[model samples]
Target: MSVINRVLRDLDQRQQQQSKGSYTPAAMAPQPLHWTWMIGIAVGTAVVIVILLNLYWWLTIDTDPALQVVEAPVTNQPTVIAATAEESADQAVEEVERGTDAESASKPALQRGPVKPRELVQVPPSPTESRTSELEEAEATTEPVVSEIPTETLATVAPEPEAEVEATDTPSTFAVERVQLSPNELAETNLQKARSALRRGEREQGQELLEKALTVMPEHVAVRSELAAYWYGRGFATRAVAILQQGLDRVPQQSQWQLLLGRILERMGRIEDAYIALQSVDSSSAEYIDLLEVRGNAANQLGYFSEAAQDFLALASLKSEGRWWLAAAVAFEDAGEPAAALRAYRQAAFARDLGVDARRYAEDRLQALGGS
Candidate 1:
């Protein structure tokens, strides 16, 4: 057989064999179906579907319900809080008003009508009271009165009018007496007279008399004070201060000497020392009242206003007349106490019959201070 016929014959034999028993068509073949693999595939597909369903639920489900519980609205909160706060405030205000009303109601009532006095009624004593009074009288009357005989007193006695007694005036023991000075005091008096002469510009005679008086009593405080005054009149403050200080040392308790020293120190511009000397005087001493006045004036000039005010207040308490009130007003004003100054000025104006001026000044100051 030729090669082509042989090949065709083998292909027909294979087809015949294929058409015999145990042969299957392509669309209806008894292929070896892998049950395990199909089952595994179905299970995998089911797992994937289930996973996708779970993922969709997880991704799309609403979680607002869970959050809503934590963030819920507070119902009726504002209205309730406002009502409670308003009620508390009203209660507090009502309490305050009640307190004020109670205070106002408790004030003393004024008289609305004329007052009638109570009538006095006298009652007679009871029997027990009369008996007790009689018992007390009986116990008190221990002495008996004696009676004169009527026959002996038969003669009539003429009655005489009583004489009037006249009061006599007696002289007061405190009347000023002419006191004779001792030799030393007289000499010191002469020295003061001479110093006065010098102060009056009689220099030659004053120097002569002072020299004579100094020869007599060299250690007299009056003489020394007068000499210091003379030096002060001559404008020798240092010498005046030294002499006055010596006199003060001799008579430490003498207000006149201290006043002189203080004056000299003040004139010399020794303010602190002057104040010290002036403050040594006792305010209650009648002897130093004049000296305290001088000190107050000096303090005023020195601008020691608080000190001046204190001194003026003391003088005011003494009821001093003339310039005391004026001094007090100036001192108070300089001390930065405008209210007290105004009061002092008012008192001064009233005292000095300058009421209109004082009132105007005080009113102006008060207005400047936004009114009292």
Candidate 2:
């Protein structure tokens, strides 16, 4: 029995040893980390950072209602009235070196607001009133001003006083000293820098440079126009008007400056002043079309639809845009000239530059007036 037990145990041990020897464990190998996936993750992170930075830069200049311009006031700049003719001469020399165009009329994207028809005062005074003085007669003989805007609109356009502001306190921190610096060169450099900054979307920096330029040369027409254009594009027509008005003080007969001022006044619904400014422009000037547009807008705002229609028709003759024709047709309709309106509408429908909505308007007007 002892011999049989030993034999059975040996048989079991031999079988276990055979199984262990046959199944030699394969050597374990470590799997490599996915470097390609890690690279993809790093690239995606970089792209996200770039996008975030760009968005931040763009939003920095956004004039949200909650944000206000909080620039530090420059303490050392000379008063605009105190600015000497020598400084102006220096700036003019600088501009000449830079080859800046004196008549550069590059307009920015204009800001627009609601302009409703206002009641006009009488143009001619009644002779039977009383034995008034000559002064009274002259005052009464002045052309009627278009100034019956709603109270709310008037309130929104207040706070201009630009020349007053310049004379009292300049708005920026980087002030220039009249006696301590390289006058014209400094101003030119600043203006060039301002243009560069604006092109790069650095609005505040550009604005600061412009303020510096104006400090050195308050009546610098190009600098004033550029600065005014910036404000005008930002919906501050009063600010633009004030700046340009200051420019007009220096060069009262400057046609380009007057044209821009007229355009701004029209946008502000100062129809009478705008019309007068437009009338001052020569008909043979290069800006004839712009003058027409400005005069037409002013006339339209003052409820002179017949005059507006005539101006628009002249504008249509200059440029074959459907929008102009459409505007002319609407003005004609307002003037109670259905035939003229229908002719303009038909012309508008066939223009290649015709917008979908403008086309629809022309068709509808034509249908209503019983025209093809």
Best by lDDT: 2
- Worst 10-residue lDDT window for candidate 2 reads 116-125
Over 4 Å off, model 1: 1-205, 208-221, 284-287, 301-303, 319-323, 333-339, 355-359, 366-372
lDDT of every predicted structure (CA atoms): 0.65, 0.75
Give the per-residue lDDT of model 2 (tens digit) for 1-372.
999999999999999999988987688688877999899999999999998886674344221211223344677543232223355445445544332232123322222223222222122223443234334545645667897899999888878589877866855577776665565667777889999999999999999999899899876667888899989988888888888888877767566777889977876778798887665556777777887888898889889999899999989988988888999999999999999999999999988899898899899989999996
Please provide TM-scores, in order, for all candidate models, with all chains considered together: 0.41, 0.39
| lDDT of residue 357 for candidate 2 | 87
